[model samples]
Target chain A: MDKKKDILSLDEFSVEQINEFLIQTESFAEILKRDIKKVPALRGKTIINLFFEPSTRTKVSFEIAAKRLSADLINFNTSSSSLRKGESEIDTIKTINSMENDLIIIRHSDSGYINYFAKNVPVPVVNAGDGKHEHPTQALLDLYTIYKNFTNLKDLKIAIIGDILNSRVARSDIKLFNKMGMDVKVVAPSMLMPEDFSSFKTKFANNIDEVISDADVLYMLRMQFERQERKFYPSIKEYNKFLSLDMARFNLMKKDAILMHPGPVNRGIEISGEVMDIETLNKDKIKINAQISNGVAVRMALLYYALS
Target chain B: MREKATVLNSDDIERIIKRISHEIIERNKGSENIIFIGIQKRGVPLAKRIKENIESLYSSEIKLGKLDISFYRDDINEKIKSDVNITEIPFEIKGKDIILVDDVLFTGRTIRAAMDAIMDFGRPKSIQLVVLIDRGHRELPIRADYVGKNLPTSLNEFVEVKLNETDNEDKVSICWI
Candidate 1:
């Protein structure tokens, strides 16, 4: 019932709580395997998905999760709402809260939007993603994928490559991985690196080779070229030269090193077509698609722990 | 002397369970074709205990199952908050004599809801209700076949049955509204 104790960061939960959440998630996973994959856990509860920016996977995944838990869901987009007609974010959220929503899952282009809204709202606020700030659930699912594979995170090396400054995924992953005792290294061009990266306790690598050697997991992030108003590089060819994960670089990685991508990838821009087709790097090899299923599990755990 | 409805202690509940186990064995002529199904949260552990007790007396194991009747409850509109731990029915139940166990039996609405939920699984040969405490004020004709203790009370009074399996305590008390 305490609204101030919301899950703003993965670090707020202790290892025991995390493990308990995972264990409960396993039960939900088992429940999902049934013919009728719905539970009455949140039957009468209402969840509102408010996305200021456009999204497909995160939006649908959350909708499916709510349905599976038997919670009534309402999805709002900027295009369909009065926000397009110059309505303020606070006014929109206030209107939704007045209608008796139990929870709100928000994705916004503005930084601190979710945090600010969470402070104002009485219901629990879940951050789906915020502008280059944090995507804690995505990071949790990513870490969950790694933990499922390696069985433990202690001392495991993970390399997050490409566009660190523009990636909310990278920021969240760095925080969660460090909290879980993983050795995290961020590989990005100096221009794309955040100025105060030292606070995250992550090692910076300008060269992928310096970090790829001992990595247990290689997380490739999609470059936000579409978001950049001006070109950050001379050309697409020049950008690929410094950042792309080609076949050669893929071969250099440890054989057991698992590959991960928060998708909607630019195929040849961030990752090579050859490397994407690699038997070990593909979805069939590591079952990264299962991470989508794990997203539901993790979210189910979060809702259950917070509301139940 | 006026008959007073007394509170049942933890030791009394345990003793009742032992007697119920003996009665089940004697009635069934052995634990064959018998299944113990507990209604959601509180009934689950109670069913397991009853099954364990039955197994100890008889060489063969008695099948145990759980029925979560939250979705089938008639008073769905009365629930203001969501319960995160949803019900899960784990096994098949067809043509089996089911002992539906619950912590307390009051107005019999929970039992009625449970019956509707169980019918979805398969046809049971028969269902015999069992409860730790039966506080009499039945709105429905539903009755427990095997009750640990029965207390005659007014409709305004509330009977709270606490079990160690769920509530972290094992006692039954009657409190006035």
Candidate 2:
């Protein structure tokens, strides 16, 4: 409803515009619950998923989201794409642009390559992930998950734990949660902390114990080992001692507090296997699975916002 | 928007609703298998009033539901003017006869979208439409089984249906937009 052309970043939208996407998400979420889980909203439209990086959940989520809306989608195979044959990135995109797709969703290892694609392409571009710059859709789905649990996001304390420096999810979540009036605090090892920490508006803590008791939402960012160029921590054993969510940390959390992760989770690094198992055994606290399911609905809302 | 004329005042709307209620009951032969589903916003109150009228006068109860057809709309390219409303179909509609209610019938696109939305839930035995007003500029081939008033107008004139539940007054007016 805000008439935004692209969804590259959450910073380009106002709070009301972001809330509008959430409101539309409510309608789309209901559609997924029905017996027939498809709509004709994006009928006959073509969507392209161009991922320059390897991903599992985000790629499949966007694919399912597009199909559920009755849109034709094609995933560009980076391994066999023209870029490997020494074609320029812009020229390769220009060749694809000649096909006249309705939208393009991209993920690249380069920090700001999505901006270049969005600038060069005529169609709307959605940033699935761009290095450590941002992953806006992941943040939106995370917001939707939190919104489903809590009545109001304002003043709700969210402690984002794990790798903050190399996590695009952490960067996007901090910006969005602060915009939604939530109290955000990043808890990570000093080595995992961002170099330009002063640029972030959220509070910083070196350990999770500082905010584990008070936070309404404990967001565990995935430790992006692939993104880190060098060793940020000494060992997983030492990392687990400082920041891993074991049973003791789980017990300290509030009764209604939700645990989240922009997933592909490290089983024994960010959270212990016992704690992860409690997610199914307990009262629906671990929102990792919900985050994945809501990922489809939230992406549906974003796709609708971009194309419609 | 400038008001052109008041088509139906408070009392006229009440009398029309009463007549339409009788018509719906007589046509269906009984209210035994009827479930009233209203389009969100103004249609919801009209459906509730008709359901209540049938309940009290005929001494039979009927279930009511609300539907929002925003997602099913065909006009995704164009901007939708209204805000999205909640769609609540609590009971099973598979074998029940559905009486779809709305405030006005103009382009018939809303009813088309609403029908597509209802089919997604389950197949009803039958779906009969009931509208308070028929403005008569149909792009789609849709018609209501029960009608309150048939006020024909030009394309420029907009039919405004106000109900006490949502708008604090029951009045039907035509305006130039």
Candidate 3:
């Protein structure tokens, strides 16, 4: 497929485009330092945030970014909308498009819902998060955060752990990390591993010992108990047996391995309470909170490039 | 390759300033709080000359400032080898009838970026652009409010403006290179 025409997936964006986007993002970074943080770049432009699932960070970050660019924002919650009354996904998006929105930022519960919506929507569609599919912006922000810290992406060994099967973040990060020529390893319980994961061409590890050893970055995804209809493991104790990132495991990992988690973290379930309490893990290396702010910068760059 | 030069001299510059000053006074109705902000390098000298002419004619001083729009420039990183002169603005420009003076108005990106930079100082009461030469073919939606000469040119051609105070000569030329 022609690269520019392949907007259905975020994987189509080349490394050059990502680099250019980062450089473009630096132009707007000065806006954050100002007292009245706003730019008139997208003035009078309308942006629709259509989130089918509940998200505080992604939704609010996008809203703030749109507002900062002076774009008119309309937020739609699927639970409260006609979607709850069984309105088809296409019908909902078409209805929103009819309002003459310049762009649509969507997060849905079903995987590939964003791809489906992007195919249907006339306006530029930004994938916020789609089921267990992909969250491109989050991954972009993740990359941006990493780039800000390290000033490089090539040759970095990043280990993505936890519920890989249900993580849209992991899916997007895996693609982006690989595309940027970084070495990636997915460490997760075998039950939570995707079947076609090898297509990503990254290493898979069932043991955390092998995965975390000499790793540059450790990206931990939250285990979604809500996604599994039946309990995947017998008990929280059983789940922790395979999944928990305890102090011992954390100590075994490389000293420079930056621990990260996309939050609403189950403190003791996936990562131990003591691990979360570690000053270096929580304060220094772990910059998941800072990632929320970087989302605006990345999204601003994306919107500017795709629209302007 | 011959070292060719076309002479405009100081007299030509004096004539342009005289014409521009008359136009400014006529439109502004007495230069009250009217300020001239030059877009670095050549524009600053041109602005200073215009301010001098306005002061001599009307017996009143027009507030003059200089703006170095390098930091606000979009092409700074892309065209890394390009030379950018020193920028200096002497006074606050808030709530003044600001006139951005540039030697030549071409693609308009410079003006657009300059306007973006100008907002950082403080909000101006009104901004009116005055250019020494308005060579058409604007990539951006920008226009000079007061133009000395409107020279229609193609995209490939270059418009050069030289001021005696800065360039050791005074001239406006269109070079086909």
For all the predictions, what are the DockQ values?
0.14, 0.52, 0.08
Give one digit per residue, the lDDT tens place, for model 3 in B25-118.
Answer: 7887778878988887788888898888899988987777776554455553243212234444446777888888999898898899788867
Model 2, stretches more than 4 Å misplaced?
A1-4, B58-60, B77-83
Report the error of model 2 at residue A30, Å.
0.1
lDDT score of residue A46 within candidate 2 = 96
Model 3 spans > 4 angstroms off: A1-8, A238-242, A247-256, A274-283, B1-113, B120-177
- Give TM-scores for every candidate, taking all chains together and pairing residue i with residue i: 0.75, 0.96, 0.70
Q: Is candidate 1 or candidate 2 better by lDDT?
A: 2
lDDT winner: 2
**What tens-digit string does per-residue lDDT give for candidate 2 at A1-308?**
35448889999999998887787788778778877899787888899999999999999999999999899999998989888989998789879889979899999999999998898888899999999899999999999999999978899999999999898999999999999999999898888888897788778898888988999999987888887889999999988887889999999999999898888889999999999887777746888899999999999888877876
Superior by TM-score: candidate 1 or candidate 2? 2
Q: What ranking of all candidate models by DockQ puts the best one first? A: 2, 1, 3
For candidate 2, give the lDDT of residue A222. Answer: 80
Steric clash pairs (candidate 2): none
Two-way DockQ contest, 1 vs 3, winner = 1
Evaluate model 1 with DockQ and give the value.
Answer: 0.14
Clashing residue pairs in candidate 3 are none
The per-residue C-alpha lDDT of model 3 at residue B4 equals 34
Which consecutive 10 residues in model 2 chain A have the weakest lDDT in total?
A: A1-10
Candidate 3 CAPRI assessment class: incorrect
lDDT, candidate 2, B99-166, per-residue tens: 99999999999999999988988999999999999999899889999989999999989999888999
| lDDT by residue (tens digit), candidate 1, A1-308 | 34434666676788777665655565566557655677666778898888988898888988888888788999886787888888887798778878887788889888887888888888888888999899988988887788778877799999898888788989999988887788888888887778888898888887677776688888888889766766665777876777777888777778777878888778898788877666444553344466778888777666645555
